[model samples]
Target: MAVALSTVAEAMLMDPALTAQIKPYEPWLLISGVFVLFILRRLTCRALRHRVDRIGYRLFGERGLLIWFWMNAPGVILHELCHACVVLLFRPFGFRITKITLFRIKPLVQERPYGMLQRGMPQALQLGEVQYVRPPGRLVSHIGDGLSAVAPLIGGIGAIIFLYWVATGYNIWEVRLQLIRPGWPWWTLLFAPYLILTITAELWPSSQDWRGARWLLTGLLLLAGIALATLWYTHVLVFNEALLQGVASVALHIDFALLALLILDLAIFIVADLLNRLL
Candidate 1:
């Protein structure tokens, strides 16, 4: 399988035409796709929320705010759980769930917030936090921090893969093989659009998340640089081939998932607008 994937990667690298054809879609697997997903999810949340609030206010008056919070609680809980799980996995020492708050009003009262800031009056929002004992080393600490910050992304990727398997009754490797042979099941498409949107919406890392993960990124760059230098010096074709093949295979799978997410976001926007008009 590795050799076959390496051969495919090598063939694509050798063919300028193939590279050119695929180049335009590369952005969908990186930062651009993430940015678009965040924006779309935000917009969709706002739209659906408006509808929820409008109906709730009419029925429940001031309690509508609480209703809104609980309605969205499941996703928020899952997001926090992902972070906590990653921290526990890496730290191993111990961890604590610090807070799960529907409203953080202390900062509003103080006219200052420790983390994020908003200009308007106080509003209730769901947030979760976890605290864990850091490992006692520089390199290990950075890796742990990075993993904790990126747990949601890892969870999102797993969710997409799981959804694919559930839909097609085949694991990721089998699906990839089927895709290679142009024999992927059409039934998988039915569930994929929904799962892709769900995963992409939760995959984005916050500004705070990146701040905690800076050392991890630095460590990764250093390791990558070392690896490249070693490969260049040794001229190890096997290692290079294996690495390229692995990357290409993973990239192909993620690219498909992200493209589906993009399409789903568009559909959601259109549907949200239509629903708003009807409301």
Candidate 2:
């Protein structure tokens, strides 16, 4: 039980994006989730947690396992759907929807004159060829790929903004931050990278050519580099002087960097994959 809790805590800490997201309200959520898990673990004879952990590992892979670092397509699709719905609500006629289909094709051949046949014969009929493609859409067509990337960032940023609004309204910034400080476990910071990655995905340009994909990848890398550099500089010049008051300061900076890189890498990979498939 101790080992399990430690492992879970470590995993959460390592994922800076997740950490950042939960950091603001860590004590309340973490304590509540843990207490709930504890009770449920007892009720189920610890079977449910084991089963979930096993399944999650199978789906998400063990930590630091590159092969397991696959994106959840359903999550991505829903994110895109949310964007589509929003667009339709505001500008219904501006967008069109299309469904993608996959099919198989066979080649056909025709007889030709001897001279023509000698050069090249007409294709003969065949039946086993297959092709997979996305269906056409106007609104989704233009933004499906892009929207998936953007939704998470919007969600994360929006959460932060909402928090700020609430804090200001109730004069809770100091109180809330203080309450959250102790339980701001490392894992919650992962949300930062998650947001960055999603936004980056939204910003990546789409193209059906290898060259274009290369350009997009290059641009993303450059942007990531710039963002990282800016963050580092700010940490040194501003955060160090203004905010780093305790031992947690170094950890905080490191957490921010990790989240940023994670986001950048995810964006680059998704855009590159899409470009490759199209090409």
Candidate 3:
């Protein structure tokens, strides 16, 4: 096991592209970017709250209002599927999905509440819900729950990767960092913008999801701290050097992920305006 870990560490160290892309910035910036995208999604949705609700009401009044739910169903389904997939991955034989609520019987938040006091109210929404049985085991359960909780973000990662693959014919596993230039008509006008809005809007984790995974995040941080302390204490060993390099390489990849998310935010802003005009 030690030998295998050392070999894998050595491979991570040898990879330059992954480490070089974001040389000046810290890896934590990527984590912050993740949060920024979350806020941006909320703001974008809030801005469109009135228009979206208006469209839904106009197209299908109180009688058949589920049409709006159906319109956004693709994104909702994909988001929940990501959570389900992660649960299955960790649980294997034990996972069980209890239920999936495609639409709320009523809006999660009120539509168009006026006055400064009402501003505190959440924007109108038709969020879907998924419930499932968690697997047994403390550590395994924490990891599974954490990953499942952030499943929408995981889905966003997949969306960004799929967009990259479609635009540049590049494999994400290779850690390629080439951008699809803004001049690319097909990307700028269509797939890129659509994917950005679709993925970003679903990246918010519900409060229950966060509650389920809180300890899992704490445990990860503790483990990371230990790894850093060990690396500092073993600076003389070649294996330690490889481990440090591997960590840096992983940091760069995270930076890339964050950058992609930020770019998606920009795309969503533009698309949101276009949508407001059209719908």
Strongest candidate by lDDT: 3
lDDT of 1 by residue, 72-124 (tens): 44444455567777766654543333444423422233232222211111253
Question: With candidate 2 superimposed using the best TM-score fit, by how many Å does residue 39's alpha carbon deviate from the native?
Answer: 27
Candidate 3: give the clashing pairs. none
TM-score ranking, best first: 1, 3, 2
Which tens-of-lDDT digit does each residue in 1-279 have in candidate 2?
999999999998899999889776554443354345434334442232234334444556653122111232222333334434433433333333232111222243343211110111012322111111223454343343333223334553444344433323322122233423453454544453444333332222212212213433465689998987898877753544234334344444333333433445545455544544454
Q: Estimated TM-score per prediction?
A: 0.58, 0.25, 0.57
Q: Output the worst ten-in-a-row residue range by lDDT, candidate 3.
A: 112-121
**lDDT of model number 3:** 0.58
- The full ranking of all candidates by lDDT, starting with the best, is 3, 1, 2
Query: What overall lDDT goes with each candidate model?
Result: 0.57, 0.37, 0.58
Candidate 3 residues 140-173, lDDT tens each?
6667777777777778677767766666555444
